[model samples]
Target: MHNDTGELVAALDIGGTKIAGALVDGAGRLLARARRATPADGDAATVMGAVAEVLGELLADGRRPRVRAVGIGSAGPVNAAEGTVSPVNVPGWRGFPLVAEVGRLTAGLPVVLVGDGVAMTAAEHWQGAARGRANALCLVVSTGVGGGLVLSGRLHPGPTGNAGHIGHISVDLDGDLCPCGARGCVERIASGPNIARRALETGWRPGPDGDASAAAVAAAARAGDRAALASFARAAQALAAGIAATATLVEIEVAVIGGGVAGAGEVLFAPLRERLRDYATLSFASGVEVLPARLGSDAGLVGAAAAAADACGLWETAGPGGRRH
Candidate 1:
């Protein structure tokens, strides 16, 4: 691929619940945006249709100029080399040809693919929380826990584009059997659904709206419900363990966290900070700092653009040196 083309690129963020698209310029500012709900439960074609709709909206908009390439950050197991994806939450997309499909939709524009976590990391490292940090971990803690790593000042997307998948890392080896066929993974204990599940199982009921989500659980905890508090505490504890493990293994200087569950504010972070003291023991892991993500909901699309920039060589404005695991 040619390096840093200095042109506009189409960016897509595909998740189980939503597909967001945008046109981002050379400097990373979004020029146009579009979105569609993902038909995750539908057949493969149906899901593709939703993505097509998103692309149609962006491409059809008269205000935006034609983009030079397309970048997709998808819920994965994504194979960047093969240009395929198999997201766990979206069952219909096993080995889906996302890159080719998206390329065709955009009139054969060059397409780039990366795991959603890697996309987020790219965004963070480019202009968000991890911008100046040489080593960092960026995490999304919504429906599932996803993560990516930055090492020596560049995003590190390992072979097959799943290197920094911290969500599936086993923290509680003997704890619970996860859907990913792993036992005691960080996601099993720290994802939004898991948090709400633990709270509900512990006798915490939803309020008048009858919404039994992690937000509801957070609200209950804020209202001084002991069960809800306990649930978040447990999730925070697991997250702390996972963060410490990453720090110990890779020597990251910072951990940037984002997503729906992170919206719980201090209710989740307070305990998480407290618990980190217990797990980050080694001297090399002592200074690892945890911070809230700065990009908000736009991280995915922004990161998608950033990953595209990296893949197309548009993100090497600083210097030519880079690394990969």
Candidate 2:
């Protein structure tokens, strides 16, 4: 159902936790959506079944926007060249043929696949906090720390489609070993799970409910827990160093952050902004602004749509009748 006069794109945001689908208009607005919990532990086919279920709902939605193409933003390490994905969190999907499967499911519609981080970058650049910026970095710091870059006003997917993998970038040459076989990577030190792990290891115990998530740690820090505060401070320091390094390496005007750890608000950002001054001492990196992500929960879906729209050659004409690209 391709609409020549009123173009739309089908967008999918696939992660370890959930699979979300949407019909997005030319203006980057979500016209309809569907979601399903991901069966990360299931076999590959079962996991894909969940994705199919989500897509099924979108195709059945009553609004039925004329979907022109399909865009997918999946948890990486994804090989855009080969149309394969092997997200670490979803171990069952090692080297899965995602693009082909999705293409078949969508009746051979043209499809574009990008890492979730890259998709988020697309969303921010199109309609969110990074909107109007020429160069920027967007990060998602949740169960993992991942990022994407918009260099010279375009998304840089690199060859392997993992260009802006800031999480795996080794900030501490002699730091702890990461699951990605790296030493002192940003994700190893700054991810929410790591923050909670560090806090728990340093004699911080959960309350009666015994919830030891990063959110709980943030609450504890807010309640004046020294150990919890220290954990967040450490994570912030790592993030600042990473961000500063990114800015110094490639001049970016802003770094937009989101995800669970970012939900800590100033509990995480206050220290991050303060520490950035120490690491981003060079003139080129000094002016970089760190802003909270504006799209919130919808960033992934919107970003997926943005990617699709870009692929469909609609960015120049697809505005809210007049929204800037």
Candidate 3:
């Protein structure tokens, strides 16, 4: 997979905020890239149009002929078996036939579809923090929470490509209700918006700019705001419970945290690490390591390329199980 074969992967990372496209080489380098803001409130066709526009930019390059396949990492819950996506944030798409649409746009090139979390796992396992680990969990904690798993040294996206969606898992039996209709879900407790909301409810005031985001609460926590600290501690506790449960169930070795919330640095990690000690007490799960993701914002694109490479048979090892459609 490391050798240069002059073959490239056309990668698309579709999210609620943006749609990004790139041409990536076997070595995980992005050659050409394009992006557009997601028309999140628009109709399905409008969203697809944005995706088409991204691909148009990438394909317009002189090296388009070198691209062998297209890989898409979209917000979940995605059905890899059916090549469809129903991202919760993007209301216009419900069971959208994304793979077929991309195939039509790419002139029938092979396309691989995966959940965004799975894509991040592929990127981390292939080249980032989870590299070389036999089993791991990677999480994206932002406005919403999502995750993916790697087990036995390979990405494990499961049948629906959402195996490691830890956010919806209940950590507390009688806590807040999640939009997913579940009570006490990890996302309901630990997502950035929830963190900020909790802080506000507990008497944490915003600055003159009225920035009441989680980042602001994190800064307040760093400055010794009791309410902000308590909010983060609660979020950390919920996240720890979820992570520990996953580690216990699957015997993962590490948990890689990423996305905007993780940018809070020690304000989040310090409490999270301390709380994980209480929940992950089992011998097998006790040694699980937690670390920040290494790839930053480019993870989705790189992971999409990794999935494409795997689908194209360019890897020595099998990737997360899925068929190109």
Candidate models: Cα lDDT each = 0.87, 0.87, 0.90
Off by over 4 Å in 3: 316-325
Q: What ranges in model 1 sit over 4 Å off?
A: 1-6, 61-66, 316-325
Model 1, range 284-319, lDDT digits (tens) per residue? 997899899988888888888877777766545212
Candidate 2 C-alpha error for residue 224, in Å: 1.7
TM-score of each: 0.92, 0.94, 0.96
Task: Compute the lDDT of residue 72 as modeled in candidate 3.
Answer: 92
lDDT of 3 by residue, 56-169 (tens): 999997988889899899998899899999988899999999999999988999999989988988898888898778899999999889999988877788887888999999
In terms of lDDT, the poorest run of 10 residues in model 2 is: 316-325
For lDDT, the strongest prediction is 3
Which pairs of residues collide in model 3?
Answer: none
lDDT per residue as tens, model 2, 1-325: 1234677778899998899999888667787888999899999999999988888888886544577788899999999899999988799999999999988887888888989898888888888888778788999999999999888777777776777889998889999999999899999999999999999999889999999999999999999999999999999999999999999999988999988889999999999999999999999899999999988888888888887777667554222322334
Query: How should the candidates be ordered by TM-score, best one leading?
Result: 3, 2, 1
| Error at 103, model 2, angstroms | 0.8
Whole-structure CA lDDT of model 3:
0.90
